[model samples]
Target: MSLLRAGIVGCGAIFPMHAASVAASGAARLVAVCDPDANKLESASQLYGCAGYDRLEEMLERERLDVLHLCTPHYLHPPQAILAAGCGIHVLTEKPMCIASADGEAMIEACRRHGVQLGVIFQNRYNPGARLIREALDDGSLGAIRGARCSVLWSRSDEYYAESGWRGTWSKEGGGVLINQSIHTLDLMRWFMDAEVSRVEAQLANRRHPGIEVEDTAEGLIAFDNGVNALFYVTTAYSHDAPVEIELHGEKGTAKLTADQAVVTYQDGTVISRDRLPQDAMDYGGGAKSYWGVSHFKQIQDFYRSVSRGEAPVIDGREALKTSRMIEAIYRAGRTREPVLL
Candidate 1:
């Protein structure tokens, strides 16, 4: 009924996006922030004019927050979210939800046990092009699914991994390209297929980034039970942060997605294209693109609505579990050099 008071943990690179989104949303306001890094916490407090704490537990104790937004590192997500849920604060975490499925399940259980909501931020779902494709499928205009191919050619240099100690390590940031850079694509693929992934065969390589523990590149194939199949190639060793592309093929039509643009072709060769959607201003200050315009804000508003209405978020913990499980499958397939059947 009223604006949800919020606190954010981890004032790192993605922290500003979440802070700004919550600040802009009519349904929420960021009242506090937390980070292990004192400098980051101080800077965020100065920027947002909010109280800052070094420990999340302290903030939870000191502030009567209605929501806790987690922009922390991969491995820290589960414990932090579970802690917040235990405090009766709903959680909205950035993806890939957590590094492991067990952590995700535990986080879900904690939230359920405390009677709070758990939401994951896969803001790509709010992208205009993605919404168009999902609408087509829901309306039966895309016909039955046939297959898909997703490509993420974004680049991450050696310095990118070296700059952060927690990143590029399996124990900390999880896997490389698939989990970090292209997880939204993976989620999109799962969303487009609209079915459980039955099998995965994958290969991983650390070609460009020197001394990185995880793969800078990965290639994988996924199969769904009803015979629909998809191929995925992702790498952070490319020339730049290029537009992500996905081609969706259905029985009677096809759709091609590039960033926030889409092109659809009917069985009779009639074509429709959406190439002129309003674009977010480019901010390459941190190398990677900030994100699609207003996606975080849109999702934040929706999550607040879900909390108020006793409904699940558009992308809840269970949906995020699918993405994590797929990433795990890819890694297992690569390590064993055999298809992992799920």
Candidate 2:
């Protein structure tokens, strides 16, 4: 079969992973890229040997792309995906589906109407640590999940936001640490619980950064419909980007995970652990940060397989909206100081 043609938008920091993944995939080809920045576009065009455009519409019209990857700012996801859907092009977008649940719903509906796939990139799910924990829970090795906790304590200096025009804004990047950095953890929490959220009680603050319009820190308690409770805390005020940690306690055991490793200890004195493979073993040649994990390629390949089989990708719009709803609930709960129902 001929490889599917793929086009990526936004040649920013995250572009390399997407570009390299598509370039390496046997099921797809990187035929085009789009970005408003001329230097980035020209560089990517030269490096990838693909056409680049300053406008998305022009790229869409010029390239016969089967799939379009959105690596753009958070606010641009909804409209861009919808536009691609209208063109009968499948969309694979980076996380936090959109700033609001309604927009996510629209994006999903648009893709459905166009008969196209809409996948969200939650690559962390493919991590060795995540896979082990998910298997333990899925196979009843972890018994009934009682509660969970996760944290993302990473630093983002003033210059980090100052350099990126959309980094700290509510209108573009959505919310600060919660939406930007910790949403992946939130998604993983929900995915592991495999339960609908009942409500959330949360608080948001800008403890360190004074000029930003969004929160630099957030803490929340989420109640799941299955009676499992989760506590989440995130802050971008630390001295460095620490490894994110998630711990799940269950009737049979407790499972703890960092970015590269996971440990599960059962009540009956059995302990299991999984560690990330070395860089060479993973065959990941991209320049993405180590903490980002090496699963973007895995997830992209899965999406290609799903499309080839004419099925929805694992983290399709609806699946991803589960976390988006949770994020929105946390934001509302933070604002009202009351439990917001999902």
Candidate 3:
């Protein structure tokens, strides 16, 4: 089988991961990369031995790519995706999907009109540990999930945000921690519960990084349509960096997963725990725990299979809209200091 030809936009911090994934997948090849910065393009091209262009149009015209991965800043997601779709290329955009619900809708419409597949990079949902929890939910082992909580209490130094031009700015990066850092956890929470958030009440604060234009911390209460309630807390200001933890409470049992380990306790006196059973690592800045980079590869391979089989991608554009809508509702709730209904 011929490998899928992939082109990537925005050769920034996350570009290497996508490049590595394409290289490792064997199902796809990084044919080209596009970035506004000549230096970034040159460096990434040299590193990956792929062609690079300073503009998307040039790359598209030159490469005839089978897939276009939008690894750009938050604000660029919608436009880049639309353009990619228009060029008759499937799109794989990094999440938050888009900065707003309207933009996400626009991207979806563009893809539908062009008969192109659009997927968001919510690789956390692809982790084996996460999939196990989902399996438990499906089998009713978690039984009538009552409530859930996800905490993305990770810390980011000022230098981390300073590494890029669009790091902490609202116009470029959308919101702060909630959009950039906590979005994966938020997506995971929604996926694990398999519920749509019907309402949200939130409070956002610039508690630590006053230098940034967006919230550094946000807390929200989410009510799912299935009568499941969840509390979400995300902050980049924690003094001690903590792993993102998601806990699901059920009538028969409760499952807690922190850093890719699953612990479950049941009403019938069954307690089981599983450790790092070949799960994708979170994209924390290099460490023993880093797994985000490789997971992108897994998702891309899945996308290729979906394309070949003429099936919907695992995290299709429409499915991705749910996460973006919830995010918008949270922001609205935070701004209005009241519950926002879906």
Question: Which candidate ranks first by lDDT, i.e. highest?
Answer: 2
Colliding residue pairs in candidate 2 = none
lDDT tens readout by residue for model 1, 1-342: 578999999988888778877877778888999988988889889888999999888999999999999999899999999999999999999998899899999999999999999999998888778887888888888789888999999888788899998889999999899899899998998898788999999999998987789999999899988688899999998899898999999987999998778888899888877653446543323233445566777788899899989999989999999989989999999999999999
lDDT of each candidate versus the true structure = 0.88, 0.91, 0.85
Q: In angstroms, give how far residue 316 of model 3 lies from its true place.
A: 0.5
Error of 2 at 90 (Å): 0.5
Best by TM-score: 2
Number of the candidate with higher TM-score, 1 or 3: 1
Give the per-residue lDDT digits (tens) of candidate 2, residues 119-211.
999998998989999999999998999999999999989988988989899899889998999998888888999999998999999999987
Per-residue accuracy of model 3 over 170-279 as CA lDDT, tens digit each: 78888898888999999889998787788999999988876688899999899999999999999999986787899999999898888667778888898877655444
Window of ten residues with lowest summed lDDT in model 3: 280-289
Worst 10 residues of 2 by lDDT: 279-288
* Backbone clashes counted, model 2: 0
What lDDT would candidate 2 get against the real structure? 0.91
Q: What is the number of residue pairs that collide in model 3?
A: 1
Extract clashing residue pairs from model 1: none
Candidate 3 displacement at residue 237 in angstroms? 0.4
